[model samples]
Target: MIRNTILLAAGAAALFLSGCGEPRAYGKVDKTPYEIRECNKELYRGIDTDPEKHIDKIVVHKKKRELAMYKKGKLIYACKVSLGKNGDKGDKVQAGDYRTPEGSYRIVRKKCDPRLYKSLMISYPNAEDKARARANGVKPGGYITIHGQPKWNADGHADRFTLAHDWTEGCMAVSNKAIDALWIAVKNGVKIDIYP
Candidate 1:
């Protein structure tokens, strides 16, 4: 009787160790591999392009969701961007409208330290924007910028995540690596055109 009991116990232990062949999972599974999850650290950390070169202008195509950097009328760099959450509604006319303003502006300032990774402030309320806002009796939202990934995005592994949807309040957002390059290459007072 003791020998039979021992054998039965051993069989039960073996079945338990087999774990029904496959483990069970619940909810959404994150399939991003470890390497891609930490991609921001592994990608675009070096200066493969000309380090001494500088950009003169920036053009943002809202419809295309792209930002292009140019030097002396020649295209040098272009990157995907996330625009205002309500950008499809049209140009911004009032504060909190959540639309990217259309027309020309200047990069008035560069913030090395910002809530985001980095940023170049844009002069959003150009005379035209202000006039239009005033005529409509609404405030022209300001503090617009072309900036890098948010703090949550860190090195920018989440950039693709951001690019998949329009997420900015009204700013143009790029990857942290792209901002690092822009921070070094773009100077204050550079002209930028935001197009619908």
Candidate 2:
């Protein structure tokens, strides 16, 4: 009787600790969540944006850590993203603030950096950004982008970690393969809207 009582109590405690009676999940995700234990193309297939899709708008939900692509007004593709340290807090106010700016922006340029793979530069510090910064006596920062993970992380490590946290300096980031597809699907003048 004593052993049975102890086992039941232990099970209850375990359930309580797991929160909502379910274990927490981790690692990379695509259309579905799965365990991506390490960097191996053989082990974990990368998430991709369809190149042929006519992507017109890119929407970012900072708190969700997701970037969704749209055609006309319909959702077409989405991929995991990492953002600046203060990405989920509020809009960026100044240079070197380490916060991603909020509101509508456009892809003004595309850049190549061997380390970051490829990038679509967003026109941050738009008129609104400038006004807000001016009112606060600050400098609205510029040169933000939606880009790929660092080359080292891209090779295989990102799937295990990048989506789990914020690590950028006011930029949004995706996996290399995702960027490869996005690089082709999007062009200068595409719209990008970011939200907290």
Candidate 3:
């Protein structure tokens, strides 16, 4: 009888404690949020005052930690890029912990979670990378791609000023909105040179 009473008291205590826990906040997202895809299409269709300029390719320099977009061999856009969390100058990332690779590559494919507003797949670990990694006995890092905020922020809205700095593991990253524009402009097999 005593044991039964003790068990009942513990259960009641647990229930009471659970009810006293803090309540989580739940509310609708602000309607002011920006949409990347819509913005990208608008930019592409807009009249260009400078018809002579055209973006041709992209170059990622690890030493300079920068991302430069080019057109007809002239730089059209340039921005800073954050490399692997471990910092620049290292072998390919064997695991996924947000580390950017260091080398020249090309944009081979572009894919997204669809659920995710934007993402671009870059072809990393070329023959040179594979040979280098094999020489060192470490696997070349793989799955390098440009992407936007994860599903948690799938609305494709993120503060640009804050995200402008380097922040990708091995892949290049721009604002979810900016990335959307690049996705349309850059095609598959477009050369992307990453320097160390």
The candidate maximizing lDDT is 1
lDDT computed for candidate 2: 0.69
Local distance difference test, per candidate? Answer: 0.70, 0.69, 0.55
Descending-TM-score candidate ranking:
1, 2, 3
Model with the higher lDDT, candidate 2 or 3: 2
Candidate 1 ranges with C-alpha deviation above 4 Å? 1-51
Q: Estimate each model's TM-score.
A: 0.72, 0.72, 0.61
Candidate 2 structure quality by residue, lDDT tens digits, 90-179:
888898777888899998876655345567889887999999999999888777888776544546443545656676778887887777
lDDT for each residue of candidate 1 in 78-109, tens digit (9 for 90 to 100): 99988787877899898888788889999887
| C-alpha RMSD (angstroms) for model 1 | 16.2
Q: Give the TM-score of candidate 1.
A: 0.72
In model 2, where do residues sit more than 4 Å from their true spots? 1-52
